[model samples]
Target: MNIPYAIPECRVAHLVERHHDHLVVPVRLDAATGCCPECGHASRSVHSRYHRQPADLPLSTSQTKLRIEVRRFYCLNPTCRRRIFAKTPTDLLAPHARRTRRLGEAQARVGLACGGAGGARLLAHLHMPASRATVLRLVTRMPMPDTPAPIRVGIDDWAIRKGSRYGTIVVDLDRHRVVDLLPDRTAPTVAGWLERHSSVALVAWDRSTEYARGASLGAPQAQQVADRWHLLTNMRQAVERWLHGAHARLRSLPLLPGSTVRPARRNRAFARSTTELEAAAQSRMRWQVVYDEVRHRHAAGKPLLAIARALGLARATVRKYASAETFPARLPHGAGPSLLDPHVAYLAGRIDEGSENAMALWREIREQGYPGTSRQVHRFVAERRTRPVRSGRKPRSAKASASEPPGSETLLPPARQLAWLLVQPTSVLNESEAAVVSRVEQDDTARAVTGLARRFTALVRAAGKGNPVADDRDAAADIEAWITKARTCEAPAIATFASGLEADIAAVRAALMEPWSSGQAEGQVNRLKLIKRQCYGRAGLNLLKRRMVLAA
Candidate 1:
């Protein structure tokens, strides 16, 4: 800012007063000066005058100074009887400040950017010097941003001291900065803030019901925009739920599949040029072979136990594949030529040749180099006898054996039948369980639903965990830890779930702990000081604040 100076007569405004910290202006007063600023009392005699400090532009090259003619006046009103008062100026100042308004604002920028010490160091590097304490005081005392009421607001909670306390940071979506903060992220606390500042047209927040309750309470008219991230998080937790609920069903474990290949340790031997999709496809391909072999053996009357042992896998994993079929198992009712496709021709020819017993077929198969165990050969040959009367005697024993589940325990993927069995209640029969597991493993729709159910149940279970009987107060501490994990997720649904669980968030966080808060917003205020420090070789406070906000 440039002040036009005069000594009764000036050629022109030759000197442009530029302020690096703040700008100052001179005001003249005499017995005939102007109206009294305080008490509305008229004054007529002047005490004395000099240039009083006023706000100026910080970061200016020249040591810009305010040349104000300060004055003391006597109240003429008999009723008031005041002796003398220092007349105040119109621009920016509280009372008794030696620094100008511009200078104070400048201090705010520097203090907030680099912090006190950093700002002080940088300021000293410039012409005008000040202590870190002075800079910090300005940062604290300066007014926060106060734009008028907003139509749309965003509410969220963030941790100040994680697992201990949380604070709410509200933002006017339209302006996009700090609106206000609540002491706690609880429903009522946030609701109160909303009620006080209630013009919000929309409340965009993560899926936490605390904020939801607050939004409902404070800004009843506002529409809630549940963040997509929150929704996904909730959905994922829901899937985990089904996994938990299905835990009991996993009783009959199978063998796990092992990898046949390993990555090369030498950099030069590694395949670096592969694309992401190609690499993923190869990874899938590795498991696909094992999956195919397992399914084939399952269909061929080789029990999961034998195959898992042969393949060196956990029984549970073998069961997983075997039970890949959807729940509510379907009956093997197809009217095929034989129960076994590849074995049917052999069975028909053997039956035609009058070789009827299981021993004869097993003996014949052994001569053909069957590497698998004899029991599988028996099961397959017996399956042939169970078909119908037109070809041969269809034995009830053979039929029952076909329907029976392979009790071999290795953690393998369940056959379509076993998957349904795993999801069923324990009260059911093995045959019925097998049928149901088969149904579930086959129906994509049912499987999808169960997956979601599993995840949700898991999350709930996780949330409920506290000091279990196994632990002491550590159980309570454990619950708090889980909730903290839930809160930190950037996804809205996850945060919202954690928020909704606010009531049961745990004993430790029950009081001072915050799951979410706007401490980062406050941190940004401090960061503004660092940014200012880095660039404050010479800069104005207004420019600094603007830069900090924009850059941030």
Candidate 2:
């Protein structure tokens, strides 16, 4: 019988046995003589013979095991220390190994692609039985190809366990491949690795102090470039903070003339549907009972804890009620901002003009860039119709008095939404959004912040697109000018944010001047997360590193 071509060094002598799910083939080495390991002497004289069993790759959907008759040869040289040496098939199987080299190679590849448990399941599907631990061992034993020194690199941190432990991933930006994964996200760990790769010319990263310090210590000659996306994101967060602080002022601003004005009447139907009044009354009654009990207990000279235990209240609650202060009003949770906000005024106008059909209003707004449901419009219209009108003489205009600031009645969008609006290019905003943004820009503080934000965005776009404005000296000067403006601007939040940028000015300047970015590094981190999650977070760092480098 002829053996398969995969194990060509051995020829099949005969079929030894056949079972329901497995086939056993007895084979022998085709070579007439074997070479001695110690002296490289070829010997044909056999000392003894033994049967060896090793598992081979599956044959025709059935498990195949080879029962080979291996021979032990006596050394012909008199001076040789070894008397007898066993003949082993180097191409078929390693010494003392239970499986063929080809089968082990396939298992290792499967382990690299899918992690241990996943790979085991996959192998089972292919009728190649292997355990998760075996697959993991094969993966760890797999060799890694040597990589060249990186000239342009990006570094970023990824969570091993989010909010608890994190590690760093280093990427070769020019090659667009991950180079190494450090054990921890500390300065010493990163610095130790960077010190070994002195050929790195440019290092791109986010505003992480640990990375900055490590890069400076290890690769002082390398230019450090901060990510433009991170810089813009930080600036947006600062703008949002300032907007949140100014929310009260924005709430008091008067609406512009001819703007859709909401009447100050209670919605009886909405109140009934929500049971809001009943909830408030129950809360008030509960708090009042607690307050009366606490005051009585305090007057009786009972300790706070005793009063708490007697009344089944927490000590903190009892102390709060015992304190002589006015009852604090419970504020209702605010509704989240909706995409339909910009068109709500237009919807109200259409309803006032006697087009009370909600579906028609939804279609009109859809044409005007409203990305919301007709159900939301229907709810709005239904509530508006149930407003309780005042039964008296004709009311005065709902517009604010001249003493009030113009546009005060128009509440600004939430901080995040307002920040998004401010950062958006004016050409993209609809008529209503543009007007709102224009009104906000009229404020000196808001105008200063918006101007700085726009300038920074232009710089980033220019750098990303390789425009001429990204010239190192020119970009540096522009950044300095913006920082000066920020410091002098009336917005304290903007000034604080600028101060932080000034401290990291070198990295920030590199961000504007150099074309390299941490974008590629960030992408690698995301890929790492995917691989980590695939293993159900059971694979260790060494196993994960092998998968990342080899799989890439």
Candidate 3:
């Protein structure tokens, strides 16, 4: 049977073999002269012939294998390193390759789309089985398309092993593609990469001192722009710190005349269970014994290492205990296995359905495979029965006036929540949230910080839209005004933040004026994380880089 499309530059000679799962077709190249690879000279003199078999793309549901009759030819030119050469079909297969070029291309596409294991599984389903390693090999061997040096780029670090190891990623913000991945986040490493690609003009990055130094050293001509998101984040953190510092004063402030203050609700789930309480007590006793020993030894002028050796504790632990003024609180052991855990959902459903009798529930669970005694179920039920139900009326102090507005009796939320509200625009807040903002603004420090935060937010928003507040000078003036107000405010948190902003004033100004940002680079980092997780964290740096560049 004739098979014209079986392989390039070859025709099927005959059906050599057939099996239940696959078929083998013997094919021969149309007689022709091939160029000598070493000298680029065409030669037709036949030297030898041999059969070579290679796997091809699946034919319908069965695998197809091509058995080709290959030939050897003698070099015709005398100066062409005169010798014999194999006449393999270059377009059909690469030298010594076990699969056809088309099949390899298909496998590579699978690898590119789904990665290693996923690609292997997909190929197997498509009747083109290949191992995960093979798929990755094909992907790595695929040539990457060349990209020119980017003009505007963003640089940021991603963790290889979080907190211990990190690498840098450079992205072309204009084209929205990855430029390259650096092996380390060090200044010299990034600087070296930047020096090689001298086309970089503007570099937007986070407020990392290492990256700042690298950008300066590598691409000194490039203007560095701080990330807007990071700037806002820093400002928010400062506001939170200020609020934390003023927590006591804020708590003592009067909500209304004659109003009393109530303590915040405690998390019942966070409370230690009976078993955990016992474990914590034992742990505390053990730590106390160690702490007393360390203190005694330290008082006797024993070295930390000597104390550690004598006590069989780590030197750091010994030093920590020696310097500590009081015994550290022991953390409670985590919840252990319980008979009720497996039946918790069932118990909840039963309670919701009005089955409140612990005895009946216990019997029902027993029928469903529970082994616990009825007494345990009764205790769980009793706890649930005694749990407090929150009332609609907000808790208030007796000193608060009875004439206070409805829903105005509650004390302010935690400082963090209050800071979050302050960060958001008042226009987007609902009535209650707006009221909270008003109450917070009544505090002189909060009000001043809130105003400055809103103005900075507006500046950032305007810069994002390419319509910054006036020109760069006016924008600088606005920043200066905000900083001045912040530094003078009663809130120490805001003042501390302002001092930091003053130190990085140039980067902050660039952040508010420059159109460039590390937004794209951050997005690519997220993409890298996803790819890393998909590979189950087994891929190395080189493999990850290859995948990212080719996939990008």
Candidate 4:
């Protein structure tokens, strides 16, 4: 040591072992093994060493590689006169396999956890041979969460794709995490799942019947709370239905068929400019002429059916163009010298003279034998604030009066405008539109419309009045009464649709009474629908079910 100690070489570079049950195998061996791995034989003499290739994690800009100098041993045991064998590790994968154990696990996740096709693609991208089936296998291996009996559980269904088929999804209401996905959305399948997990105390679900059936059958003691947002949505649909029936006769009804129906391309659509428009109009005129010729022929003792057949026209289309009600609504002639009629000259003279106060003018007009109300006068005057130009281009109408030119200066009075606004719907109606409604609705149905408009206006005013909010408790009670009336209309569909909700209306009402809302959950349902569609691309039931439950 005093002279200089020679450094001893390290023989053992690394070691990797594989364990199977009670057996341990040295898959990767160090250079120096004092004792034999296959047999207990000590050796000080070095017999031989060779490189053993093993899989490793990929390195940056390089494919991963591992080389180990595994030891070869000589069993000097007289009883065991056999050659020593090189050991293989069970923890390590088989030779020639590129993937490591952990990498395989992650691949399984790509297949099992994500949507099947997506998982397949992802794994393939990662150089894994994962098919949709392989992905499905991974899903099968995942353990179902042992969700504790949640006080409030949410039940719904997600299809693999839109219109493909659906599977029941249960969520832990308290945790807001997915609990279990069932095989089908049918009553029996979902019911079986619920019966197995029977301690659920409360359930929140949509207005779907099968889920309700399953819930009623499986969790009889559970209190059901229907999604209120859905209830309100149903109410809205009902209102829209009424509106559709009420306004059915309006000419501008949006008659485009369901999105699936395609409209024939009009030649006019390709035209871009006024010249093109004129050309398109001429083409339309030509068709109109043909149609009129057929009609006149029919009217002058020739048969319509014969004329239509001779002209190669679809009989129904022929009738549509020829016999259609040419005059729908008759325009009212000279209703009056509208408060509008005076706006241009009146506001122009006043504003020109620096005496224009539309509000004051509204009152003056009301006093000056103007049949219309102050609100109408105000609205008319207010509309002219744009100070539109009177272009020297062709005049649009002979109806444009001296006082009420097509382009005129307008004035508005604050009180009069507000009065006009009170006559309109509380929602969606613009101020100008509201004013028009205020003026036009002054006829036969005006009073009823006015009463409703006023009530809504009062409600709005009260909201903005900084007045202490009166107790809406009575109002809420009245809504409940209305709800009861609405329920009577649903007794037939109620047996199916409104059953779970109806039976649980008390609980639902309680849920509604709570400050919390089911809006988010309902929104989640919609999101699920979108997800289902994207994942499955309109798949069949089994495929759809698989996609929905397994999709990421």
| Candidate 2 lowest-lDDT run of ten | 265-274
Estimated TM-score for each candidate: 0.44, 0.76, 0.73, 0.46
lDDT of 4 at 18: 30
lDDT of each: 0.52, 0.79, 0.78, 0.49
Model 2: residue 294 alpha-carbon error in angstroms: 27
Residue 224 alpha-carbon offset, candidate 2, angstroms: 0.9
**Between candidates 1 and 2, which one is better according to TM-score?**
2
Q: Cα miss at 237, model 2 (Å)?
A: 1.0
> What would the per-residue lDDT of candidate 1 be over residues 419-453, giving only the tens digit for each residue?
33343344454643444444444444335444433
lDDT of 3 by residue, 402-459 (tens): 4233333355666567787898888989866777677677777778889888877777
Worst 10 residues of 3 by lDDT: 263-272
lDDT (Cα) of model 2 = 0.79
Give a tens-digit lDDT track for model 2, residues 1-552: 554555658888885578887888889899989889999999999999998888888877778889988999999999999989989888898889998888898888998888889999999877677999999998999898799989999999999988679999999999999899998989988888889998988899888889999999889999999998998888887787676556555555555656554334321121122365568679988887778878888989999899998998877567556652434333232344667668767877886886766788899999988887887786666555433234442211221132233443465666677887887778889877777777787677787788887777777767777773636788779889889888987777789888988988999988877778999989988889889998898878988899999989
Query: Residue 261 of candidate 2: its Cα lDDT?
Result: 45
